[model samples]
Target: MTICTRFLNQSRLWKWSVLTVAVVGFPWGVGTSQAGFIGGEGTDNPSRQLKALFAEYWDDELRAGPLEATFLGDHRYDDRLADLSDAAHEARVKRDRDHRHALEKIAPETLSADERIDREVLRFTLDDRIEGERFRDRLIPITQQDGIHLQFAQSVNFHPSATVGDLENYVRRLHAFPRVVDQTIALMRQGMAEKRMPPRITMAKVVPQLRDLAPKNPEESPLWGIVAKLKDWSEADRDHATVAVRQAIADKVSPAYAKLAAFVETDYLPACRESVGLWDSPEGDVHYAFRARSFTTTTLSPEQIHEVGLTEMARIREAMEAIRKKVGFTGDLKAFFQKLKDDPKLKNQSEAEILGRYRAIFEAIDAKLPDLFGHLPRTDYGIRPIEAYRAKAAAAGYYYPAPEDGSRPGYFYVNTSDPTSRTTYTMQALAYHEGVPGHHLQFSLAMEVPGRPAFRKFGYVPAFSEGWGLYSEGLPREVGLYTDPYAEFGQLEYSAWRAGRLVVDTGLHQKRWSRDQAIAYLEENTAVPRIEIVSEVDRYIAWPGQALAYKIGELKIREIRAQAERRLGTKFDIRAFHDRLLSLGSVPLSVLERFMEQNQQTEAEPQR
Candidate 1:
């Protein structure tokens, strides 16, 4: 319903960063320009042709990715899954090449300013995608944490079985599962042949995940067990669907899973490298460089990112020390972190308490949102625990967008997998980030924008989205949410944790730090639990360069806000500035900066 800027109709979501569901993946779509497309000051307005090109690209890309479309709530491809064979890969490459050529033909100087920005965004998206494909990373499809199998498991949520036809369509997907799984196996074999395997420890995790999803019977499968959600279906229809699903699992799905599980557990796992860093892969340094640039939307090298991370880590630690002193802790910062980690006071003993606290945080934040934002989304959102099936693998919390038509409220999934270890300190910050002013507000506002190109309306840029999410975490501190010192400490700790990421991520992938080194760094610098630290570090190893986006994006946003406030002084209207920023949808930080400066000028000019 809302223009789906989200990716993975082909092979997205789970594989694209898969770190935080709130703002997943890289550069699927960016925000629209503050001004919508209008004819430039000439008769030669190629804006029409350019807009047509974007429409064509969106339509073709969506059709090529039916699962992605379904996730976007487009039912056109509900019955279809991606063709993940060798030919499909080639087709995607050619499609990108052709689109790049088509876009190159459009003269930017002849178009309006907004169209030129769109032109630039389209070119960047295609270029990054083309370069990534050239590396043939698709051959190494499943990492320790992400792969097609996880996507298959989550498709049930993406495709609701509201009607009997929906159930039938899902059964068809079940039958098609073997083909997708087999293609993935072939890709893995190719990756192995090329010596591009993920590290062994990471791969070990992947096999267990595959086992979790590979139910031998249809009744046990997530896809076939949604009997309660299908209230409209008759008993006969449900029974027929159930029987077909079981048979499909017996013949197609289970056998395919068996083959994959065997390939991974036996052959591939042994073949995987012991080293966890991506820098050790074939031409890995170069590949990592491109990814760093793509995710951060900057050409900062691994060395530069590592240095920045170190500097930021030290700075955040100093602030954490201040908090440690505030809490009357006599020992050093590491001791304080250890105490925070062990403190029973920080625990949310039950899932209901965790979810309930998040809901209350949402309500409190909701009432205060109008004070900060000039334009608030009409769309509402809800809070729920991350499903037990995926909770173990999911991050602190993830956000799901509301349908463009408002058929579904947006969802913020709080992970309660290890409840005793799930601290309450981060809940306020996480709630702000995933629920209200963070993802739901920014994403819903983008979807609610009227008359924009479909692509911009539903865009997903990692730096922009995640930057806003992180930036939002601090906004609540100003609004007075973290009342308790521990909660305030949690807020600082969360920020410090992100700062640590800048160091640990770059240290692992670039500096050749071992997985243990990465884990120890977080342990020393933040109060996050050991298991959570292990999971986060593993994610960084599995998906290099992605962790760089949050801090990089947040720093840029805070810089812009600071500069704007400095320049505008008393004229700086936080609400107006925020509304203007949200109005631009999801542009890159650089694009955001330009518009922010331009807006300052607009405000500074004498009244007409």
Candidate 2:
């Protein structure tokens, strides 16, 4: 999943923009450098003008979202945390409006085809972000799945720790944590005043996480991992950095978390709404509608999407049943789900065993990737168990992209909290989806694509990214993976799980389905463990319409591929098709479809 840090409440536009910014020395707003670019050679070149505009926006965004800059491998602002104050949010909105206005002045007809695509994407991004300003998402920042607290706590994992100066910058960020917490509390308080808050049930899950994060012993804090990474440092420097880190955590970090926890437990939790659906909050109906469009990048209404989900569930269920019978299971689908869960052979032996299996699965898939894609990422990836603090509430697996500068590799974090709850059957599908030929492959390559603007390189579109991930789970079948009957069932189960998400996410948020109702639907439809089903339902509750992206995205890609296969017939090449799809980086589904159509026309031309 793309990290949807809810520091600010802008939807897909904010989520991607927050992650895309890079460091440039130019100050925010039309700097002298930008003025020269726009007024110099760009006076006659529309493409240059637009490129200059995008660069200006990148610099402004990096200044505003420093943590994002650090994540992108730009350490210039590593010492600063995001300013979650109301003033900062208002400024961000104004900047987006300004960028949109600048974009509107450009004549798309005069630009090259590639620049036109860039302009359209930027226009869509700015419009969505501007429209999102009217929503109250920023007020209710904390959720079971994500918020300032969780992002800040886990941020150490992304910080550069190769040098002593890097550790010093981390110390500064640790010291800055209290101020961010206070800003977050102020927002939550405003949310309470406006009667906009997360579901009481979901907020209940956050208090413990906050307490876990703010342990009494400073050494026990997640931030201490930074000090642990100082393996090659001189003994004196390591000792000095450790003392500074410990002091900063004890004096600034832990107290801030404790204060935030108190605010949630004593004030925020009791005031949170009993309802789980976003429809219960202010302007919820309108917000849910926008989210559906934003995440899916389609015009489909909630009613239409819910119907699409039902059709997919029906179609995938047929495939699942065939696999069940192939394994000689006499029981029905629901019984088979239980059998899969209860069988010891299907459960993980240990955390080490889970990590080892994932590594092996990734290696096997890596060897086969050349047959399916023309290009692969130069960035490598690692498999690590999700940190113990957040593992309980985390997903089964998630992929975080590597930095563009190669300071670190992408990591696939597997939840080894409850080994028994994790199944061996789903491991291959999980590995493929989160690691090889999936998010790592797609995201890392997007970052590495040449000549793309910084925003396009690092930006994420949920439908495009998640849809590709879901599609990748099945792509291995063409290369002779998932030959095991049970593993094939696992792949089908994962497909069903994503399909079930479309139903459950819409059901909870749009149809007023109770939390239990959503859980019950997944429990009956997919072979996912009960614990995972409950967690998935809560995720859908916390993040409305996000789950819909996987199935919706996958279906569109599959449709486009089928069209290509028919058009090219025996001339079709899967490797070239994949290379073309990914080479465009993260685009809206509409943009992707248009590009693919143009490519097909070009391919069909009589002569080169």
| Candidate 1 residue-wise lDDT, 1-608, digit = tens | 01122224312322121111111221233224311222222223477657656665665666666666666666656777878788877877776777788778778888777777677777877887877875677877886555667667666777767677787787788778788877888888898999988888877877766676677765666665655576567888877776776787778876777789888999889999999988899988888888888878887898898888888878888887888888899999888888888889888899888988887888888888888998899988887676665566557888878767556788887788879999888788888877779888888888777656667766777788888888888897777777888877777777877788888888888789999999988888888889888888887887787778788988998888898898888888889988988888776677888988888888878898
Per-model clash counts, in order, read: 8, 0
Candidate 2, residues 283-389, lDDT tens digits: the string is 88888998999889999998899999899999989999899888899989999998998999899878988988988898899999999998999998888888888
The TM-scores of all predictions, comma-separated, are: 0.92, 0.96
Judge candidate 2 at residue 192 and give its lDDT: 93
Highest-scoring model, TM-score: 2
